[model samples]
Target chain A: MTAQIASSRVQRSSDMLAAPSLDSILALTAPGMECVNAVILTHMQSDIPLIPALAGHLISGGGKRMRPMLTVAGAELVGYAGEHQYKLAAAVEFIHTATLLHDDVVDGSDLRRGKAAANIIYGNPATVLVGDFLFSRAFQLMVGAQNLRVLDILATASAVIAEGEVDQLTAQRKVETTEAHYLDIIAAKTAALFAAACRVAAVVADRPAQEEQALDDYGRYLGVAFQLVDDAIDYDSEAAEMGKGKGDDFRDGKMTLPVILAYAAGDEEERQFWRDAIAGFLNSDEDLERAVTIIARHGTVAATRQRAEEYAQKAIAALSIFPPSPIRVAMEEAALFAVARRY
Target chain B: MTAQIASSRVQRSSDMLAAPSLDSILALTAPGMECVNAVILTHMQSDIPLIPALAGHLISGGGKRMRPMLTVAGAELVGYAGEHQYKLAAAVEFIHTATLLHDDVVDGSDLRRGKAAANIIYGNPATVLVGDFLFSRAFQLMVGAQNLRVLDILATASAVIAEGEVDQLTAQRKVETTEAHYLDIIAAKTAALFAAACRVAAVVADRPAQEEQALDDYGRYLGVAFQLVDDAIDYDSEAAEMGKGKGDDFRDGKMTLPVILAYAAGDEEERQFWRDAIAGFLNSDEDLERAVTIIARHGTVAATRQRAEEYAQKAIAALSIFPPSPIRVAMEEAALFAVARRY
Candidate 1:
C-alpha cells in the first residue's frame, strides 16, 4: 500500500504544476481557524495587562498560522467531528508563539513576523515571562482535551523542541557541521511539533495506530519541507517576503542545510570564504552579495529546493492511506504548498 | 475548629523559642526526599551532554531543596503512603530550577545560589533554552502523576508564578509601589507554587476538599514567610550567607518589604534619599550602609521580620487540623523555621 501511494504521489506532483496556496488551504479550515482564534484571545487574558498587551502585539501581527492550520486540517482529514480540536489547535499555536518569543530573545533579533519583536518593544524580562505564561496556558489547553495520549504527544514534543533548539545552539557558527547534524536539528526543533500536531488528530478521532503513525509521518515530512524552503528563501527573498532581512541566517552565522551543503561541495578557496563568512568575518552588503553568488554558483539553492520537493512528495504520499475527501486533498496540497511557497 | 487551631498555634509559637532547622526537617523526610533526588537526576539526563552538565552545575550548587521537602512533608502530614508524591516533589523542584535559570537571565545576574550564574558560564541563549527543556520536563513529570486535579493545580500555579514575576517587573524601581501590591506579587510568585505543591499531596492521596484547602493555606503562608525573611536578609545578611551579594535587592532597585516600609515611614529628606537610592543613584558600599542605617532607623527590617512571623504563625495554624504526628510537628516547625532562618 505504501509503495503504491509513493508512485501515485510522484505521478500527481508531475501532473500538477502548482499546488494550492496557503490562503486556499486555510479557507478549507476557516471555521476551525476562527474557533482557534477565539480560544487564543480568551486564554491570553490576565489581570496583568502587560501579558495580554504583549501577547496581543504578537498574535495580531499577522502570522500565517500554518501550524495550527495543520492541526485543524489534520483533524478534519481524520474525520474528527469533536470540539476538542479547537482547543488543541489553540494549544499548538500557543506553543509555537511561546517559542517565537523566546527565539527572538535568544537570537537578539529586533523583528519577528514583520513587526518589532515583543522583546524589542517590551524588553527581555517581559518577553521571557510572558513566553512562560503562554507555555503554561498551552499545557492547560492540552489538559482540557482530557486525553492522556494527546497530552503525552504534546508534552514529549515540547521537550524535544527545546532540545532541538539547544542542539542548534551547539551547532551554531561551526562550519564543520555536517548535513546529518543539520537535519537532526531541524527534525527535532521544527518537525517534532508538526508531527505531534498531526498525530494528535488521530488520537482525538480515536483512530488506529497505523493511521496515527501515517499522519505523524505526513506532518514530519511536510515540516522538513517547510523549513528547507524557509532557509532557502532566507537567501533568495527580500525582508518583506521573508518577514526578516534577507541573509538573516548568514548574518547570524546559523548553520542551515544550504550552507552545510555548499561548504562540503566547495573548493579550498570557496571553503575558506564560507568559513570566514560563518565565523562573523563577513559583514557588508557586498559580502552578502558575494556569498549569495557563491551559493548560487554551486547550485545549492536549486539542490536545496529539489530536496524539499522530495520531502513534500513524501508528505503527500503519507496521506494515501486516507480515502479521497476535500479535507485530505487540501492537506496534500498544503504539503506541496509548503515546498513551493517563496516565503 | 479553625479558631481552636489558630489559638493553639499562637500558644505554641510563644512557648517554643527556636524552631527546628531545615536540616532537622529534611532529616524527617529523608527517605521521600531521596526518592525525589533520584527522579531529578534521572529526568535531567539527555543525549546532549551540555544540558545535563549545565543543569547539574545549578542543581548541585547546594540549594536547600526546601520546596520539594515541603511536597514530601505535605504528603507525609496527610498520611499519603504512595510514591507519586516523590514524582510530584521532583516536578516542583524542576519548575523552581527552571524559573531560577530564566530569572538569572532576565535580571542579568552574575551569581545564583552562591555560584556563578548558569548564564554567566553557559551563555544567555543556552541558559534560556535549558530552562525551557527543564520546564517541559516538569510537565511530563506532572502528567506521570495521572491525576487531572494535580495537573490543574501545577499548571495554574505555573501561570500565576509567571504572572507574578511580570508583576514584579512592573513594580520594579517604582518607589510608589504599595505594600498591598508587594504582598500580591509574592503571594502569586512564591506562595502559589508552595500552595500548589502542598495541595497536590491531598489530590494524590484522594483527600477531601477541606483538607486540600488546609494544606494549601499552610504552604501559602509558609512561602510568604520564607520570602519575607529572604527580603529582610538581603538588607541584613552577608553575601556568603544569602548566596548572592548583600543589598542585591537594593542594588537592583527591587521593591521589597523593607524598602517599602522604610520609604513609607521616612521623613521627607529620608524619602528623598530612598528615591535616589532606588533609582540607581546609590552606588557605593557606603551608600548601602547609609541605606541600611536609614532602614534600621525606621526599624523596617525588624518590622519586616515581625510581619513574617505573623505569616509563619498562620502557616502553623493552618496545619493544626492535621493529626499530631512527627511529620505534622516537623511541618509546623518548618513554618517557624521559614521566618527565623538567617540565611
Candidate 2:
C-alpha cells in the first residue's frame, strides 16, 4: 500500500511539473510518417536535377513536418485502414513546402530552418519555378487520392493561403492594422492548411461529417495558437535560439501581435518610435532591440503567449468529441505543445 | 457567266495575296469566347484588392486570349455541347497568366504586353503571391469542372511546364545546348499546356482517344511554331514594334534556336563573338544591333521562320483527321497564321 501510494504520487507530480511534449503523437504516427516521407521524397523529384536539388534542400531540412504529421495522427485517431492517407499526407506537406518556398521569396528571407533559404542558395528564379513544380505535384498527389472533396478543400485552402499572404503584405509596416484583421490573416494563411491537413485524413477514411468537423476545429485552433507563439517569440527577449533570424519581423516591419498590442498601449514617445520603425525608417539591430524592449515593457509578448494559450485550449476542446483514446490524448497534448514550445 | 468569272478571278487573286489571319478562328469562337471572358472576369477577382488590380493590369492588356480561344474552337471542332469548356478555358488562361506573372519576376522584366510588368508596379512580393493565387484559383476552377480526368491532364501538364522552365533555366547561357535539347525545352515549357488545352475539349466531348491525340498533336505543333516565330521576331530586323522588350532573350542569354543555329554555323572568330555575347560579356543596344546584324547575315531568323512553317504544316495536317467543317477550316488557318504573322 505504501509503494502504490508513492508511485501514484510520482506520476501525478511528474504530470503536473513536466511541460507538454509531442512525444505521444510522434510515436503514434512514426510508422505512417515514414510512409509519408517516402512519398515526399519520391514525388519531389524530377529529371531536371535543379528541380529535385532545390526542393530537397528545403524538404530535407530539419522541418517538423507538422502538417503531414497531423494528417497521419488524425488517420490513426479515426482508425483509417487505407494507404491513401499517406499520399494525402504527402500532399499536405508539398503544399506547405511550396508556400514556404514562395514565402522565402516574398520575404526575401536569408535563412530557413537555420540554413540559407532556398532562394539564397538557388537564386529567386529557380526557387520560384521549383515552388510551382511542387505545388503542381501536390495536386497530382491529391488527384491520386481520388477524392474530389479533398481536392476542393485543399484547393480552396491554397487560394486562401495566397490571399492571406497578400493581405499580410498589405498590412506590413502599416501601424493602423487592427488585431482582428491580424487574427483573420493568421487564420487564412496558416490555419486553413492545418485544418485541411487534418480534415483530409477524416475525408480519406470515409468518416462522418462530425468527425471531420472536429478534426478541422482541432487543426485550425492549433494553427492559430502556433502562429501566435511564433510571432510572440520573435519579440521574446529571453526566447531560445530559433531557425529564423532574430527580429526578422521587426526589421521587416511585420505587424505581429506583440507589436500591435504594444503600439496600442504605448504613450506618445513610444508610439512615435513604433510609427517610425514600422514605416521602414528605423531598421537597425538597435531599433529591433528597442522594439523588443518596448514590447517587453508593455508585457505584450506574455500577453500574446496568453492569447495563444486560449487558442490552444480551444484546440484541445475540439478533441472532446473523440473518444478517450491514446491518440486523442496525444492530439490534445500536441495542442498544448503548440503554445508551450520555446522555439 | 461573265460576272461570275470576273468575281471568281478576283477572289482567287485576293486569297493568294492576303497574309494568313486569325480572323476566321476568332469569328468561329466569338460567342463562346464572350462566355469564357465572363468566366475569367468573374473568377480572377478576389476580396484582396491587390489581386484584382494586378491581375486586371495584365488580363485587360490586349491579350489575344489565344489559349482559351483554342479550347472553345476545339470544342466546336468536336461538337462538344457542354458548358464545362468555358470554365476549363478560363482555367487555362489563369495558368498562363500566373506563369506570365512569375516569369516577369524571374526575368526582372520591365514591360509585358506593352505596359509595365506587374512586378514593376506592385513589387515582386505581391507579384509572386498573386501568381500563386491565380494558380490556386486555376485548380479551383478545374475542380469546379468536376472532371477528374481533366484535372489529371492539367495537373500533369502543369508539372511538366514547371520542369521545362527549370530545365530552361539550367540551359540558359549554355552555348552547348543542341537543337534537339532546345526542341525538348520548348515542348515542355510552352507546348504542354497548349496540348492539354486542346485535348480537354475532345475529352469533355467524350471523343475517342484518336481524336484526342489529334488535337494534342495539333496544339503541340502550333505551340512550337508560335514560340519559334516569337523568338525569331525578337531578332527579326524588320519585325514590327512588339509588346515585349526587344531582344529580351538575347539580353537574357536565352539559347533560342536563332542563337543555337548562329553559333553552329559560324566560324571560330564568329563563334567567339557569339560566345562572348551569350555569356553576358556583351549586352548593350550596340551589341544587340551587332548580334542582329550577324543573325541577319547568316539568315538564321529566316531559317527559324522556315522551321516554324514546317511545324505549322504538321499542325494543319493533324486536323485532317476531323471531318471538314468550318471550325476545322478555321483551326487549320490558325496554324498557318501562327507561322505567317511577323509579330
- The best candidate by lDDT is 2
Model 2 chain A scores worst on lDDT over the 10 consecutive residues at: A8-17
| lDDT over C-alpha atoms for residue B228 of model 1 | 94
Best-performing candidate as measured by DockQ: 2
For residues B222-272, write the lDDT of model 2, one tens digit per residue: 999999999999999999967889999989989999888998998898899
Writing each residue's lDDT as its tens digit, candidate 2 over A210-292 gives: 99999999999999999999999998999996899988898888899999999999999999999999999999989988998
Off by over 4 Å in 1: A1-16, A237-240, B1-16, B237-240
Alpha-carbon error at B27 in model 2, in Å? 0.8
lDDT of 1 by residue, B1-343 (tens): 2556545554564555555555546666898889999999999998888899989989888898888888898888788878999889999999999999999988999888878999999999899989999999998998898887788789899999999999999988888999999999999999999999999999999999999999999999999999998999988733236787677788888999998999999999989988888888885889889988888888888899999999989998998787776667668778878887788
